[model samples]
Target: MVGERSKQAFERAKRVLVGGVNSPVRAFRAVGGTPYFADRGEGPYLYDIDGHRYIDYLMSWGPLIWGHAHPDIVRAIAETAARGTSFGVPTELETEMAEEIVELVPSVEKVRMVSSGTEATMSAIRLARAATGRTAIVKCIGCYHGHADSFLVKAGSGVAALGLPDSPGVPQSVAERTLTVPYNDADAMEKLFADRGDEIAAVILEPVAGNMGCVLPLPGYLEAVREITRRYGSLLIFDEVITGFRVGLGGAQARFGVLPDLTTFGKVIGAGLPVGAYGGRKDLMALVAPEGPVYQAGTLSGNPLAMAAGLTSLRMLKRAATEGAYDRLESYGRRLVEAFCQTASHCGLPATGHAIGGMFGLFFHSGPIVDFETAKACDQALYADFFHEMLAEGVAFAPAQLESGFMSMVHGEAEIEKTIEAMERAIPRIAARRR
Candidate 1:
């Protein structure tokens, strides 16, 4: 529990790095504490610079599905790196990765890699605009599609954690083009299309929203979106950055049986490396440069290291799929959710928990959370208390209530049991703070 080294490191970091962190969420601003500096991760555990270890539920914000530095991924990266880091030229690994992605994901026909999720989404939006010859894009209020100017309005994750309605630097003109709607509300979406169907280029969203604390799509909502978008001549974009391989071999689209026109992906695809991709119908993806008019390019788009790591991860996932990896994830996820509910009830605190596959959320509220408003209504102060208490008990969770906690294949029964025990012990202490 001693974070002396981390505290000292933070003091040094703030003198150089912005907010003493590369990412805003790592600042621990919402959780009211200094961030712990992780030294390394092995299996499901993270060891910090202060010589303290915790059972990690963050999983690098949902990318390390196979757990930290899986030998195969490590070896792949190492071997690829030994050849050359960046060629800025074509490589067979890129083709191999593209083939693997197309084979695994039901919706993707052709994919182009990018360095980050932000780039993938930004490019996808551009493609949508070009293909439909329209400008405005519809985004769910709490769904985050990265930091692109058009997507900053009412975005979730770090923005929600900081309680910012919209980022400051985005121009009014850019924000105006993006329409925001509530998650899981079919009528509102229908009305949006009816009102501006002609001008709307695409409707983009997280098919299974993870940014606003792992909210799942309501029954029939995704289907409604698919049908509505198709009817309106607008493309549907699934920002599967979190859910792609984490949900299943085919992702949320396959899990829910709704195929989107375009899908933006990152996270699990990279196996903890920096990579992102967007792909869909062959005709639509063929529009990207060198093939057609729409333009998108990256210097490190398909870097050998990233491709090797991604390929290794995807291959492992494909193999695991046959052996019921998702089934085990569902079983473990349900156990964790149920455990949280039991612990919350015992502590006399109302709680709502939900999970799909390896992604889950623990809402500090009494009832189901369906949209941004209700999701926000969950007590942040209480969550902060729970987060710190759980951290103290050697369990690491996302520091913000709006971020979902991830479980990995490495989080076995022993780890799950330990996590639940930690939650049970931490809940009383967190509850005591409220009184």
Candidate 2:
């Protein structure tokens, strides 16, 4: 329950914080209630400031794969912090971190570290343009690649969650360079490339679209896009900020056996710290500064603390992967999806969901929800009702219908069972309310 203290805190926050929250979705406008301010988190659980404990599926919006405050990760951050927070000088830790990524992800032979996913993505596109000598870039219609000006046009997630069509400051001229095609539509991608092939520098997409509600790629969709880009002399860039390590020991590319020319990463790599990276073929990444002509630099690009935390998380995942951890995570997610769909069916409410690796989505639509156009048709009001009712039953999902729900490695049978029961209890309340 949102207690008096949390309500008061939100009231006070409104006096200063924009929309009473740092992030728009955190304001809870989509879900229609006051958002709970997090006090702290433990394995698979988050405690709000009002002394409420709920099984957490948000996982800090897809970063906490190890769950909150794992001892190894905590120790790594602490030890690195004690040595000195940030040093302008280079450190071997950065080299080791880069090496780990190069070794684990199949397509990345070189990397440029940045502080956030937006930086990584924007930097990658700049490199893509410089390499290809083309000014135009193409992105999937509703796949978000962070908040860079080029990405603002037809973006998803937070932009969708808050009901903002598109950000105001992105110039129409910039938007003109970005071509949009519906996700999972191979023919649309092919037509777009054929029509504008010479003008396009790159085509960027999420291998598994995380933004528009965890939608999966259709059969051969990624392969088709890869072929189309290659045929047109445009680069293929996968924005794996949410799916990177969360999807597998390698990312979606390695799992699906389809490689992109470039990849962007954040979330899991940072292990709940502020970090992001973009890496690719040696020749392309070689175009980045100090190594080549294109210039992009960040003073805190490879901060030791973030490197330590991320490196530790990656190492732990490498070990756990051999132990069948990824399979376990996928199984747990499938169970939740099944339970959600089953209970909704029993209550005579339409519902559909998808789960893969550590990410899952719950929707108030009967789905074959492959693209944003289809995803948007879900019953928003029903989702909002289910969202609050589940909260009252002590389970926390994403505040918006369009966002993906994440599962962590630490979420085991107990948490899964509890969440499913909460779903069962919460579903009928939502259905009955409409009566």
Candidate 3:
């Protein structure tokens, strides 16, 4: 149950903030209950305003790869802030951040910094259109690139959670220019390309489909998309906002060995700061800004604080990668998946899950969830019960069933055990509800 303080805060927030939350999913609309207001976070734990402590797996929706309020990141932000926060002019830190991204990501030869994932993706689309001299962009049905007009056609996350068809504000002209295809269906993608290949400037998608619950690319699926895009003279854009550094140091393109023409990144890149980036082949990226006609600019595109914090985090991640930190995250995620599945079995409830790097997803449905169609078939009502139950037991997952869960480096065996124990209780309660 929500504490009185949180309830009062929410009521107060409703008077000022739209929907009583900045983000739609944070409103707890999908799961029936008052949203718990966060007071602070440390390592793997988040303290709600009501004074409840939770072993947090939300990880601020995948930005906190090192967990919340990491000392190093905090120190970096402090030091950078002491110097200055934002300058409309270029900074050395921005160049350093760009160099780091160029070195780590295989597809990004020249990168442009942005304020959020939406900005990164929207700019990438614009660059693709300019580079290819085409008008249409293809996106997977449930793979959310962002809230950009070109991306909201069949987006997931909050859009799916709210059961909205497509955002109303998006013009019909723009929506039509954005093609839609089912994720993990190579045949559908191939067919779509065959019919309208000439009109497409790019095909953008989440290489791992985190928005629709961490759906993995079907074997050879990414390779096929790459081949098709290359043959059709259309750019392939990988929306790695959620998967970038979270999956591996080099991101999904490196992990899958399938390079995209352009890649958009956020979350882990900023190390929990407000930042995003899009980069690609030098020639393609050269078309943006002063060098070319395709114009995109932001006053705080490479803000000092964001760059400093992200640079520190990336350096730490690079060092940890040398010692197999990503492997440990994967191991932790796998353990959670096992526990979730086993507990569901014990409770006599159908369930399915997948663990990839530090990201995972749980579905209140049977196995073989591949795309939006299958992901939507999950028992959301049952998941709500499980969500509330887990919250009561001091564990936190994403509030919506459609959202993916995250694991942070700070989470150890003890945290994992506590989460599993919470699941142990939560699953049985869900089963009881079903009975």
Candidate 4:
């Protein structure tokens, strides 16, 4: 059913919006088609402008952990909106959110809200520079923090999909302060510290690299990073924007049992609303105004509607954690990935996949995708074919090979079974096209 209507809308959008999309990934360039214009999402399904209903796996790019348009979150937003929207001043809901985050996340002793993931990371880096009185930051090559000037160099996700190692508009002087190293390489990290340990202000990374197709860190990689950062008096930042509550109530830091000095969060925390947060030790956080010299502020940082939605989502996640939601997620992920692997193998196509919690990735023509380079080497054309086939069969996936897919609490036995069926039907068509 995704036919003329969606295509017409995209054609019109092209005249007004650059690439016919606000975000680069939404244009469906990797999949070689016009992107479906979503009308609305309910439960586990997305309804497109062309009247097609698809069992969604992208989950709005990793938010909506409870699924789209959950009653609780919607109701909370409605009730909060009736009171007031933004005050440009503190509210009780803001304090409650901060308390909830600090209590749940292992590394967050005090938290500050921001309007988006970009602001959270942008402010966190500034705070690190102020605390350490150093200018340099060490970031992993494939991990994406945000669109900040420093993070745009060798970023992953949409940037990687475009095959641009770095973006323009970033001055060489600003980019030089950011040192890039490969993920899961502890020896390289050690060498960097040995050479410029004193000049480095912080080391920031996605503990679980979701930007590069859900690649997990190797054994002892996080522990090694923690040790190195501590040895050199550099702050360690875990960018949990995608992994925060989606992985577990305590996030990847607690799941892996390696705590960082600071943590940045988005996605699940907002429950599909626009929000982000950064927090850390009390001493370091206090340095942000009006307590100390490091100044960071946002007018809409703690908007009431966003706070209500976030609070509801966090409460649901807490309840789910108590009721073994993570266990359910693991079971569902395993079933879907196993089914896809079996189908791909039967078609004589090399494939490997991995999943944890509610996030998963399927790499085409892969041995093992452990790092960004290995992840990028995946057969993108085959992935595009599979994506189109799956869409035709009423299953939605992340359009780009480098982006990971997400499952929500609503993705139960029925939806997972249906997705596996769709994959089985789609994989052979993709393989036949390759032949």
TM-score of 1: 0.99
Local accuracy of candidate 4 as per-residue lDDT tens digits, 337-418: 7888899999999888878888988888556888888988898988888889999999999999998989999888899989
* TM accuracy, model 3: 0.99
How does each model score on lDDT?
Answer: 0.91, 0.92, 0.92, 0.91
Candidate 1 has an lDDT of: 0.91
Error of 1 at 86 (Å): 0.6
lDDT leaderboard ranking: 2, 3, 1, 4
Tens digits of per-residue lDDT, candidate 1, 11-111, equal 99999999999999999998889999999999899999988889999999999998998888999999989999999899999999899889988989999
> With candidate 1 superimposed using the best TM-score fit, by how many Å does residue 420's alpha carbon deviate from the native?
0.8
Pairs of residues at least 3 apart in sequence or in different chains that clash in candidate 4: none
Q: What is the Å distance of residue 367 in model 1 from its true position?
A: 1.7
Q: Pick the winner on lDDT between candidates 1 and 3.
A: 3
The TM-score measured for candidate 2 stands at: 0.99
Candidate 2, pairs of clashing residues: none
RMSD of every prediction: 0.9, 0.8, 0.8, 0.9
Runs in model 3 lying further than 4 Å from the true structure: none
Cα lDDT of model 2 by residue, 1-435, tens digit: 677888999999999999899878889898888888889999899999988999999999998999989999999999999999999889999999999999999999998888999999999999999999999999987899999999988899989877897789889999999999999999998888778899999999999999989999999999999999998899999999999988898899998989999999999988999999999999999899898999999989998999999999999999999999999999999999999999999999889999999999999998879999988999988999888898988899999999999999999999999999898888988889877
Q: For model 4, what is the C-alpha lDDT against the true structure?
A: 0.91
